[model samples]
Target: MTDLQIRATAAPAAPGTTARPGLLLLLVLTGQFMALLDVSIVNVAVPTIRTDLHASGAALQLVIAGYTIAYAVLLISGARLGARFGYSRLFQYGLVGFTAASLACGLAPNTGSLIGFRLLQGVGAALMVPQVMSLIQRTYTGAARARALGLYSAVIAGGMAIGQVLGGLLVSADLFGAGWRPVFLVNVPIGLALLAFSRRLLPVLPGDSSRRFDLVGLVVLAVALGLLVVPLVLGHELGWPVWAWVALAGSAAMFGLFGVVERRIAARGGQPLIPGRVLRAPGLVPAAGAIFLIMAGFAGFMFAFALHQQAGLGHSALRAGLLSGPVAVGFGLSSLHWQRLPQRLHLPLPMLALAVVAPAYLVFGVILRGGAEIGFGAEAVLTTAGLAAGCAYSPLFARALSRVDPADAADGSGVVVTVIQVGQVVGVALLGTVFLGEVSFPAPARTSGHALLVTSAAIALAFAAAAAFALRTRRAAG
Candidate 1:
């Protein structure tokens, strides 16, 4: 470890010592902002990337999906890895790697190389993110911890909103004649600044060296996820070849294998990545289904919306990005209102939010069919939907945790995180196919209309799953 890492890992300067929680929160939120920004930022630049790199349909999807794939697959393992390596060391390493990856992505000569570097970027994010909550848990207690967590959630939603605007602005400016490259190049300086000041700005706690990891489980899960994601993203474009069918079959088999391996590991008193028993828990499957449906709609909307503005409506990148500002405003303001709500409503809000948001999506689709132009009318609907979107996620997460068996809480949360990622991956892949193949981009309004309708149907399914989970939970309580 470097001197800074050593300093971060060492005991505090004084007993009962507390570093400045305010600064510490800033440090954690910054890391989170960078991670979240990258996910949505690329959406606005997707068209530019395709044209500049002469990317194929599959490569374009890969450019987007690869990062999420790596991040989702490795998140739980990253947490366990931090336990062995120490959060401070892992965090520092992740920051450096992420910075380097950003530079690589900005400088990438082709789509293949960009895809490869994006995956590396995701690896760094996986390492950096799991430590945020761990650090907050280490530094703050009780009400302070709760506030910090709320701030963290707000950062996620806000970052996503900002990412769209930023990407649009960056690409529109064509900075240094670099076009969309700055969308990624922008991360380099921020990553470096974080590296320089992280030791000073962040607080760290001791490591638990006794934690054991399941490498076999990690490998099995990775293969399983790849099997599911790859074919879905590439299948229709390739005419649904025999290989796609093989991959889908392989995905099913790999999932079964993952369960068997995890079960055997737990049977032998080993630390399995996922606990087999949690799979059988009451209401857990429905909860996962609900969360997956919610995220799928969320991810699909981002991918399709950006493309519709740029390719269909002929909006300049900056205008598209600027249009997204209201989404952030709506989400940020609504999130504050959400936080003030009674704690009892937290678990049910996701279902309720999705129920309303579904119609809002349909409403937007109806308006777009008239004209997909980014006018006062469309922007207004986006802001309203943003308010509903803000309510959807936190509550679903709360519900998932509340439904889990106490003994399986840790693994249950871990599974929820993975499922959320998987849902996003599927969303981008499945709906991306629709956006590329079905929608008539030349007809701007029709294109936008079709895409939003797709998202509406997806959200409706999520609402259904949420309704099922709600009924199941009420019956159990009764």
Candidate 2:
């Protein structure tokens, strides 16, 4: 056997007695929800953050996206850490640290400090979030595992919605005159409550000694992402200077090197960050790539759309945040409804979702293309997009892991999530950068409109990728 073979033994629920698996699922979902909330919670508060901190456009994007960058970079390593230590052990620790980081973010005196704290929050999130799936896989079998994953998807979708609403309401309420800080401070009580029960509720699996941590692979991958993102985020502000060009080139080279290093590690019979096999797995590569493109499109559109509402339409932060709430509503409805669906049918959900979303985007494009004023019709369009995303996500997770062995759940979950974060960074960086280039003060509707067209193209690509993956997987099953 090649040294690169990924192997692990998972201990499911206690043999005779059904462990209070419900509580375990609750704990996992709670942690996952909190982490996912941070991703969108700040969207509502972005303008407030910018005004209060005197942040530049680049600084604003960093404040919002820094968490994702850190989370993506460290996730694979964090998964290995969970394997080495224990999933429950890491969950508790990560929860506590995450809570503290939230406090720091609320109290941050400057933009730099806030961004730094947000990155730390990402680290804390990365540590805790992967375990939710790992524990679910470890504690449940068959039907229950499917339910847990569904609930996880529901929480994630619901959290994004709730975050936007709460962020707007909190900032508008101006509680204790805290303003944008409450969006972050709200995590403290929730994290502590989750932490208190984690020890008793979560299963404590023995560390998998067989999995090796490849630090060199981690470093190169980090560098690769940094190079790719830094230039993309900063290129517009810096007028696409020589340094940005250098960074872009270096990022491409670093990514290539990262793959080489990882392949070498696997060839040497050692574990690398991402299993060499996972990349080569049938239907997996295209699915992962599609996810990246779709998220980039989705996230970019959301960011740009938010900016348009606030800056161009003269909407208040609360009002602007509420605009995307429909998407969340659609997502929640679809995911919760799908929980009862048959397993065999789940794989084709994404392909089906694209059919729904394609027309919606075209309509949204036409609306934005109009020379006259657009009304609340845009909300309807966004809600449709949200519904499509919700439809896609739940099934997407299940389908991607369809070919993966249950024993390798930890690594599989980590790899899937890692790609998600990377996709997010790409979305925010490019969209935010592009949005800034065209959006001038006092009326950015035209520029924002143009950006939505770009998003349409990205989403179209996502649809194609999904179609390819669906075809490949369907044939494989047959």
Candidate 3:
């Protein structure tokens, strides 16, 4: 064989004499479970937190927004950090940081402190989450990779479902009269267990010799995201102050500057924080737009539903959580048939399924508003949303990834994930703002149930628009 061919053949596979797909799945799933669970676990605790900390609407918003903003900002940087220091090392350090931050959150005496600790917790999560996907990428190949991704997606759906359930149970249990504290404290043991298991189970990947940290890019990205997201989250709560508008304007300019800096870095033979080429992909832009719309609508619907169940119906945390289980069930069931659907039908099949499912929320709102008490009966809406999500998520993801070059997988994935995060942030901010603003009208006359019905209708409309867009894209592509 030629020298180049020999070298290619001789490149070492990932370490450990034997690697099992099952073990790798276990390790990666555990990490993903922790990361995604933390995202929505706090939702059920929002009321208790407001009471305990004597926090305002804005404070509660911060408690959620702060963590997400920090998490999104650090994701790209964290991936690079893992590459430089070794994924195993970064993953271990992240576990330690996450556990400690969770403890700090549990101990926090006030909303401000809790928000601060949560931001740190998010930093740790950002460090850890990218490694899970990277590890999967490094460990598995071909058909095995596809199977692993399927399992990973299932775990994500299940974990999100369980997080809400667990959050509700912890808040309702009030073990030690801890109230909302246990919601955070529960992470400690899980984090420790993951750390121990991962040390033994995860295979170490070789570090790149040419890797260099992009400090300037990191700073610029952080500032740009903060400027954009912070104002969107807090602006309405603060009554859209003058400074908020300025911050929004500044975000646009900062993002432009970041683009310029990235181009310059690329020209200088350095990797930018985000490669410009990935953003230029035609499929990525539309795919991201669809993701953003879907996420925004979903977040808004869930937030409004949670508030309505508790405040309007006087449901316990556990009860509210149980009411949302149907969505999870639907998602789980639909995912089972997802791989088979595209092959049998077409690209629009899943989107059509989701379209049919979207109106269930509207029906739910009408029922609830018509004096139907919130209980397991609300499962109709949950089921519809879950089914829609299950059918839509994978197909959308596959379409996006199909357009990506094999060599650009990591960067493309990062961009997709970043857009997902951005979509989530925008959803929570915009929808929450609308719900809060609308509810304040006519004071006590506007019940949380009414507010929720309005929000649900709005969400349903948004999803309908998204479904239409997806259909259009399908036609164009065909």
Candidate 4:
């Protein structure tokens, strides 16, 4: 065997009884939901946060982007850490940190403190989120694994929509007159409960002593991602500053350096953070590309639409959040049920669904351009788009990971999850720019309508590109 082979043995389950798959899944998935939910939940509460903390635009942007960037930059390292330490051990550590960060965010006295806490929250999520997928990949096999992935995908898609809805509710409810703090504080109790149950439910696995940490790879990758993501996120907000441009330009070179360093590590018979074999797995690259494109479009749509509803249409926070209900329901239903279809249809489904998504966005744009409120027509269109998105997204995770070797599960999960977080950051940065540039705060309805239409066109183009990649994925798989 090559020295690069990935191998590890899992210790027995907790003291008395074996971990029940269903309960175990619930425990881990809830952690996944919280981690992912924090990404978008803050969107609905941003205005309130701005008012409450007297935050500047840059600070506000950091509050949202910092978490995602930190989460993305450290994912591969976190996965490697999970393998070096135990998955269960890292998960508990991450949960404790995330929950404590949540409390600090809720109580933060200023924008600076909030941004710092948010970064810590992202770090916690980075450590926790990868373990969820690694756990799923390591624990289950056959149909059970498939079902677990389906639920996992549902949580993945549902979290963004649910965050908006739940955030709006929490903020609007103004529980105990705490205003925007509830959104962060709500995680406190749930995190504590999950930590309690996790001790008993998760399997205690042994660390892989054979594998060594690639500190150079981790630092290079983190710097590369920071250069890429920071500029993409902060560039427009800073009016395309020279540093942003320079950072964007430098990121390409840094990524090239990262590749060279990884290859050197691999050539020396060391395990690089991201194994070359994982990236070369058949169908994995195209599937990841499709995932990145679709997620970018989906996240962009959510961010842009939230702005349109509140800033453009003058909707209440609750109503704006409630507007996303159809999407959440549709995504949840489609993601959970896609596997029921016949075997032959599975490979082509993503391409077909993505094709549907492109036109769905255009149609949704047309409806809004007509100056219609989010009536039944708009709701139907949104739900259809959500259903298509679910169909496109759920299967791709399985498709990409299926091509990966079982031993590379943690590395593969890290790569895919990192792609997802980066996609969201890019989507918000680019598409949000399109929306913001076209419409300003408290603008005329007509202006807002036009801005949304333009933004939707951009989103449709992204989905169209995703469809092309999905087609490639189908061909590659076939």
Q: Give the per-residue lDDT digits (tens) of candidate 4, residues 251-331.
A: 999999999999999999998989999999877898899999988888888888887887778787788899988887888
Per-candidate RMSD vs. true structure? 5.8, 4.2, 4.8, 4.0
Cα lDDT for residue 124, model 4?
A: 96
The alpha-carbon deviation from the true structure for residue 113 of candidate 4, after best TM-score superposition, in angstroms, is: 1.5
- lDDT for each candidate structure: 0.73, 0.74, 0.72, 0.83
Preferred candidate (TM-score higher): 1 or 4:
4
The TM-score measured for candidate 2 stands at 0.91
Give the count of colliding residue pairs in each prediction: 0, 1, 0, 0
Which residue ranges in model 3 land beyond 4 Å of their true spot?
1-20, 375-377, 440-446, 468-478
- Model 2 spans with C-alpha error above 4 angstroms: 1-18, 339-348, 370-376, 444-470, 476-478
Candidate 3: how large is its RMSD?
4.8
Compared with the true structure, what per-residue lDDT tens digits does model 2 show for residues 364-459? 766875323456887787687778876766556555555565556677778878877787777778877766676566555666666556555555
Off by over 4 Å in 1: 1-18, 276-287, 342-347, 402-413, 440-448, 451-455, 470-478
Among the numbered candidates, top lDDT falls to: 4
lDDT of 1 by residue, 138-158 (tens): 566545655665676567556
* Residue-pair clashes, model 3: 0
Q: Residue 254 in model 4: shift from native, Å? A: 1.0
After superposition, the stretches of candidate 4 with alpha carbons farther than 4 Å from their true spots are 1-17
Give the candidates in order of lDDT, highest first: 4, 2, 1, 3
TM-score of each: 0.89, 0.91, 0.90, 0.94
Score candidate 1 by TM-score against the native: 0.89
